[model samples]
Target: MALTLYIDTARWRAHQQSVVQQFPGIVPVCKGNGYGFGHERLADEAARFGSDILAVGTTYEAARIKDFFSGDLLVLTPFRLGEEPVPLPDRAIRSVSSVEGVRGLVGARVVIEVMSTMKRHGISEEDLPKLHAAIEDVRLEGFAIHLPLDRTDGSDAVQEVAGWMDRLNAARLPLHTMFVSHLKADELARLRQQYPQTRFRARIGTRLWLGDHDATQYRGAVLDVTRVTKGDRFGYRQQKAPGDGHLVVVAGGTSHGVGLEAPKTMNGMMPRAKGAARAGLATMNRNLSPFVWAGKQRWFAEPPHMQVSILFVPGDAPAPQVGDELVAHLRHTTTQFDRMLDH
Candidate 1:
């Protein structure tokens, strides 16, 4: 009846525990659909993981999960002036990346983010002195550095983090704890070895929850199945069927993040060519669906509707009956499931 996310609870929990054990002082990041588990659910899981600090993407998210987590909330987004006011608990630690941000959040527990190679947010190195001066009124928790995912430029994350530590030491700033992102376990270990005094807590999300792909499965329940001839017109746009087959209506559509995809970075020439081909096909309204039938991904009869998708199951293949569940390959971060069942 719905698009459901089924979890192998035992395997999933085992993976989580393994990650927690691997990364000492790991701050479980519960943000942005909670990596497909929802924020409140992740909050409870973080509690079960015995994490003292939970990192959320925004202050409003911190406020939402406060009752469920009962631990310190670290807001990753830098707090800016004149932002929508949200009543957050005292345990919410604001991340301030600029002098103005520090001044704006006076008396609030704060983490100063230094500009990383990513260049997304954070105070520049030259502004470290100014930020140091502005943080007198606020409770400075520590510093944070968000590293870029691609290290293809030969830039080592461990070395980069060490360079920041050196800069902080030279600037006479506190180096008690440094929260970092996008660092591998070995990189984190090297940092700990280099700076034995500083506690480096990796803010992990995807690796912690979605590390084991085999532990989770997505299924779209078959709502209806109608047989059609080769030239039969069907669907909203009255598109002609490519051949004789069964039109399988599955319970997942645009609302469930079906038929939607994030922009992919097509780096090489072959990828760009493939992108062009996909675009060319899209113009003709001939697109592939994510729904898998009989171990094969089926084609969409037309663009998916709001609550259901029509997959063309060719006559040569076995057609699924109504009430059956079709496996769907979906991006967890983008998907909104009707239910998450744990076995």
Candidate 2:
């Protein structure tokens, strides 16, 4: 099999429970490589969460789990006016996020995203009136708003949301539901209290799935292990490991999100680099490989390839032989796996 994602089933179940407790009537979102567990698998899990509805990133994503999920499926992406929209399966709900897409979804069950954080779809504030007029017949599941977490207080959030609600209510449009993202609990509570007439739906992904680190881990089987001299030539580029050590080849690489992006910084610091430097100094000035051996980190021989990662497991560490297993932490959305074993 390819790279494997191991989910602590107990922890995942508990996390789901926590999410439901916080936001009752949870609409579990399952989209984009199923966040490394595959779309269909997530759909099945969401079904158990008693969530009869789910949000998907695209039509292709929706197609992946239509059979698995008997509930209403909402496609977040807007289809083009002239382009033939894929026929959503029975009971599927589509989100029309554009002005032009309104008429095309005349008889379809759909939601309309007002303003989205992703910046891809959704009707502009100026043109929303025209779009609302067009969508008079289609059953609007709700008005979707993908909010970004800001440092604002609860009062500020309530005021902003109240203003938005005023505009929606002023349009003389029938509004019932509201789907939001990235909002804090306090803010959501404030909004709920302020607008008791509207049904609130939180479209959470990251904080729901990967929120608990102890619940998730990735693993691959080591295919080979060999001792190498300082100058021993190995790997695709004939790059040397630079030190006497054992070269361990594990089944994971860029194809599984390993060494895929250059680097990403959060808030003003290069988080990856900072973490790396800290670990290097505190540990052994060591670089991390795509694969970890014997509970300790190793160094990659070179940049990762499609499906395999070469690591220089130090000569001193207990080396893993062929068919041995290796483990690593993975960025969910970026990684794809052949199997997701829930323990």
Candidate 3:
């Protein structure tokens, strides 16, 4: 009677163990809906994995999962002045990207983030000296750099990381530890070989929990089924049926992140053209739903409601019974499931 996430528990745990083995010092990231597993669940998993540190997106997230994970919490979002005071300051290692941030979090555990090519956050190289001078009062855990995922611009992530290492060395800053993201296994290995003194811990989220594609499944239970003919009015907006079909009320909707799309990066011309075609179809009320019945994705009768979606299954296709579950292709990061079953 709900949108459920079913997990192959053994396989999922095996994948997590493999990731931990691949990245010797990995910081499991549990933030932003906890990658659809919730903060406490991932925090417990991190504890089970024996991780000494867990990375979260914000101080608020750290506070939420602090009790669940008994290790140090690394807040990836840089702490700024006048922000809400961090909870459990002793166990929280804040990421500081500015001199003011360093000054603001004086006497707190902090990691100084140097700006990378991503340019989202972090202190610039020009201000490295100022950052160096400002970190005297805080417990400087180490440095961190968030790398860009797209490497098509001829810029190598390893080179970028090494460049920062060289700059930090020149600045006479501590080179004991570095936290990095988006580095491949071989790239991390090369960096480790280049700098034997530094311990590089990769902060990973998606690849760690969602690495095994076969280890998870999503299903939406059929709540009701109504046979309809062409021109039959239905749904909240009284939308007419386009053809003979069965209107399926599935137990998933806007509240569960159904019929919602996050902004995507369309790199190639073909992708951009296809995206435009999808948008054009959506404007004409031909939007498709994620629920798959009889091995085909069905069309949405209308926009999803708060707790249910109506899918139009054409007459030719076999319709699901009220108790049957329809397999759904969903983006786990954005989805909020009512229940998770471990098998």
Determine which window of 10 residues in candidate 2 has minimal summed lDDT: 151-160
Where model 1 places Cα greater than 4 Å from the true spot, the runs are none
lDDT of every model, 2 decimals:
0.92, 0.76, 0.92
Q: Give the Å shift of residue 236 in candidate 1.
A: 0.7
Residue 124 shift from truth in candidate 1, angstroms: 0.6
Candidate 2 structure quality by residue, lDDT tens digits, 119-160: 666667687579657877687777877665664343454565
Candidate 3, run of 10 with poorest lDDT: 80-89
For residues 1-343, what per-residue lDDT tens digits would candidate 1 score against the true structure? 9999999999999999999988999999998898998997898889997999999999888888898988899999998999998999899999988889999987899999989999999888888888667878999899999999887789788989899999999999989999999998888999999899999999999999999999999999999999998999998889898899899999999999999899997788999999999899989887989999888999899999998999999999998999999989999999999999999
Model 2: residues >4 Å from true position, as ranges?
A: 116-120, 150-157, 269-287
Error of 3 at 180 (Å): 0.3
User: Whose lDDT is higher: candidate 1's or candidate 2's?
Assistant: 1
